[model samples]
Target: MSTDEHLDPIPDSFILQPPVFHPVIPYGTTIFGGLYAGKMVTLQGVVPLHARRFQVDFQCGCCLHPQPDVAFRFSPRFYTVKPHVICNTHQGGLWQKEIRWPGVALQRGDSFLILFLFENEEVKVSVNGQHFLHYRYRLPLSRVDTLDISGDILVKAVGFLNINPFLLYSPRLEVPCSRALPRGLWPGQVIVVRGLVLKEPKDFTLSLKDGTTHVPVTLRASFTDRTLAWVSSWGRKKLISAPFLFHPQRFFEVLLLCQEGGLKLALNGQGLGATSLDQKALEQLRELRISGNVHLYCVHC
Candidate 1:
């Protein structure tokens, strides 16, 4: 799998009992969930073209308002006097000096995903699948009961996942992967695919079907002489093509979010659509099957 496509399996603890996420919010919101040392928090959003700055913080309390001690703060500034990102801590009514990075890979008007994995000694952070920063433990994780996000970014989803030790040590599904869907489609159910597209490949198919009959949906990505993969859905012998393909073989993570309406697509963290379902075939969508040239590392539904 490509480095960009690499993502740790979200585990049963996360997918089945994920933290109550405020899926979509304005530029700011307050989250009230105390985090533990082994928990991971994930957030997805977009950076508008005119964005100047945005921040995410884990604080002592939400009701504490302005004076709560902030365990960690992640702020990315695009149009400030100096374009940079700041990582800092706040305590005793004062903010400490920040650890700053001068440049950023996030593009304006593009979607992004950020993950904060709390460890015993440090908070490891990743942005858009790439390691970004590491902040030493300054305040106790037990005191962090709230998450505050504010700035120009449009928030899409924010949630936390508890780590399970047994799952962590279990065997992983290697390449050429295929698996059965847990319980068919249900709202709030999410299927996550993490893998690398083959560097030199012709085509690949990621599929879902009813165990008794034909495939209800087949995600086919075909390449020609160029480096693009024509991504689309093939079902009931019909194909619907996306306008473009995400860069291949460089690491990719695709998430299929089942909602009341249908499927919400996110490729490498950027959301695509919540297209309505073709109920005839969708209602019976029962099994997940992957057979393609791509190297499938991890799949969780």
Candidate 2:
């Protein structure tokens, strides 16, 4: 199927024009009409009011419902701005604003383009080819399955451009320590960690060392297909499928490691391309345990 065919269709609440209408509002007007539907579109217009706001709806397949994703607010303090695409879930509403180009001012005869790549979880908003904002959904955009555009602002020309899914682009990953294990992991703490698989199926063992007493904590591996198995501690185990290639380097998983530094990771001891600790304030080290459904095997630490 074509790329556009894979994305959600645009609703009919918008208009495209070369001679677009420009509304005149008072200096302090805050409310206005808006265009509320489309996957990928471009809008050009002049701001008659001193300030305005734009809202858009977004949904992911893995998520529950459509949520407000982006808002463009024009103000003196926030001039020439680009809003980030909000992914509702994952990493506490992942913000991919770093991938976007700096925003530009809105002026008469100036053109603006807002491109949404649903299949690839990316949004590019540009003003006159000068990239203003570019953002990517962090957690594989399983939540957003639909999109809607709406807002009230002076518009001169509006155009809808459907994109092919394969043509979608993702911004570079530059966050330092994007997938490091948590420092202080206490009881009842839910943490998620992702990292590249440097070594697959390495021995993952947890032992408690208390004065003359050492015990092995059972560790397991979970395969990618959701199968489970026990990993022998002293065996040369191959966790991932041999001949595994790590292209796209973004492969990782999240672990809900609880208190006592008890590891709750995929069976293969592999790292999820990314890791996130839902709660920031976890207590220091505690005893460790190993027992659970193995999710992934053959992973790098």
Candidate 3:
């Protein structure tokens, strides 16, 4: 017999159409079975713009799946909805809107992933591998333990899969106190930094060079209450205070990293100073802050 002849016929309950298939599982059917009761699970679906609502159906246990519980609904716009084991409605119609998935206006064949982390405090939803939504539960999970799927769309497939909560990557930052500044320095971002200063002279200056204009970057003493003030000069003749005294051979090098929120100062890879910065100063730093003295080389501030 031919493979087609031996294959089982599509179920009569499902409507198999070009866009919406019945005998075949729809592209957006909600799946709720196999380890989907109390643990978190990852949901994947292909959504066509016309699919209005997507629902998952599951069997509920009296003491396992509770009623009037909040579930985290995740998409581009995150939301919260209450789901029941038997039906979508609550005591009355109070949660009708909450239980129904609104039309997302997705394009045909648009695929997306929804991560539902059902925790004690809230149900966190991550979409497309990014953090998106959080929903608090009003009803306890002990009362309802079943899952169900229903909506104006078809679900291709649904499964309960394990996920690592902390498998995410972050970037590193570096900033110097006496050399050229790095790129991507903004008012709110943090920077890693390193530098030098003479203590004898009461007045010391540090200027971040940017093109033709030299912008003075603020420098605060990490150990003491003393603060250094600086001004940018037009020519090579930078101004210096005569009262400033320096140990003839006691030159120091420091690494200074900073963000608009705060700064950390290090010396030769060893930490020396750290402090929180004023919000106003961080917002005004349009140009990248460079290290080094004005007498050195010109930098792109």
Q: Using lDDT as the measure, which candidate wins? A: 1
Clashes of each: 2, 45, 54
Better of 1 and 3 by lDDT: 1
164-233: candidate 1 lDDT, tens digit per residue? 3434354546655767765678778788875556777776666777758565556666566322232334
Order the candidates by lDDT, highest first.
1, 3, 2
Among all windows of 10 consecutive residues in model 2, the one with the lowest summed lDDT is 26-35
User: Candidate 2: which stretches are off by over 4 Å?
Assistant: 1-39, 57-103, 107-111, 117-121, 139-152, 156-159, 165-301
lDDT of 2: 0.33
Task: Give residue 202's lDDT in candidate 2 (0 to 100).
Answer: 31
In candidate 3, which residue ranges exceed 4 Å CA deviation? 1-38, 56-108, 162-301
The list of candidate 1 runs beyond 4 A from truth reads 1-33, 106-111, 159-165, 171-206, 220-261, 265-272, 290-301
**Candidate 1 vs candidate 3: which has greater TM-score?**
1
TM-score of each: 0.62, 0.28, 0.31
Model 1 steric clash total: 2
Best by TM-score: 1
lDDT of 3 by residue, 96-202 (tens): 34432343334445665544655656666555555654555544533444444445444433434322112111111232334444342454343422122333333
TM-score, cand. 2: 0.28
**Local error of candidate 1 at 150, Å?**
1.0
